[model samples]
Target: MRFALNHIATPKLSLADFLGLARRLGMPAIEIRNDLPDVVGTMPAGAVRAAAVASGVDILSINALYPFNVWSGDVPARALALVDYAQACGARALVMCPLNDGTPVPHGDLVAALRELVPILRQYGITGLVEPLGFPVSSLRTKREAIEAIREAGASDVCKLVHDTFHHHL
Candidate 1:
C-alpha cells in the first residue's frame, strides 16, 4: 500500500518545504490542508499545484470540507469553492467531514447532503472521501454511518469512506 502524509503531521512546514520533505522521503502522496499555516486561503491554487508537481508528489486529497453533513448555511457554496480549488490544484479528491459539534444531524439529512454533493463532485471530476469524525460530539462518528448514508443517497460512485485510525479507537 502507498502511504500518504497528512499535512497535520508537519504543521510548521510551508507547503513547498513539506512537498520537498515528501519528495526526499519518497512518499508519492500528500494531503493538503486548509488548516495548515500559510496555506489554503493564503496561497494561490497554481502555486500549490506547481510545488507538488515540482516535487513529484501527487496531492492525494484536500484535508477537508468540514461540517459537510449539514447542507445549509453556506455549506453548498463552500463545497463548490473547495471543489473548484481541488480541481485547479490537481488534487484527486476532497475529504468531506461531518459536523463535530454536540448537536446531532438527522440520518435523512446526512443522506440528503451527500446526494446534493455527489453531482457537484461528479461535475468537478473529483472524488469525495467521506470522513466520519470520531469524536464524542461528532454527529456522524463511524464509517458504518457514512457508508449507510452514501448507499442511501446512491452516491457510491461519487464517494467512499475515509477511515482515520486515530478516530477509529476514539
Candidate 2:
C-alpha cells in the first residue's frame, strides 16, 4: 500500500510546507483536511495545485465533507463545490463522513443520501470515500453499514470506504 500523510500530522504547516515535508519524508501521497490550518480550504486552487506539483506529492483525498449521509437545502450544493475543488486540486477523491451525535437517521435514508451524492461525484470524475465514524453517536459506526448504504444506493462504482484506525479500533 502507498503511504499517505494526513494534514492533521502537521497542522501548523502551510500547504507548501506540508507537501515539502511529504516529499522529504518520501511519502508518495498526502491528504489535506479542510479543517487544517493553511491547507486547501484556506488556500486557492492554483496554490494547492502548484504546491503538489512542486513537491511531487500526489493528493490522495480531501479529509471530508461532513454528515454526508443526510441532505439539507444547501448540503448538496456544498458537496458539489467541494468536489469541484478536489478535482481542481488534482485530488483523486473526496471523503464523505456520516452524521455523528446520534441523529438516528434510518439506513434507507442514508442510502438515499448516497444515491443523491454519487452522481454529483461522478460529474467531476471523483470518487466518494465513505468514512464511518465509530464514535458512540455516529450514524455510521462500521464499514459494513457504509458498504450496505453504498450498495443500496447503487453507488458501488463511485463510492469506496475510508477505514480510519482510531475509529476502527474504537
Top candidate, metric lDDT: 1
Worst 10 residues of 1 by lDDT: 34-43
Instruction: Put down candidate 2 lDDT per residue, 5-102, tens digits, no spaces.
Output: 99899898878888889999999899998786636557887778888988899999997888788887777887998899999989999999988889
Clashes of 1: 0
Task: Compose the digit string of candidate 1's lDDT tens values, residues 1-170.
Answer: 88998888899998988898888898999999887653678889998899889889999899788889999999999999999999999999999999898999999999999999999999999999999888989999878898999999999998988989978776
Error of 1 at 57 (Å): 0.4
RMSD (CA, Å), each prediction: 1.1, 1.2
Candidate 1, residue 115: how far the Cα is off, in Å = 0.8
The estimated TM-scores of all candidates read 0.96, 0.95
> What value does the lDDT take at residue 39 in candidate 1?
66
* 159: Cα error in model 2, Å: 0.4
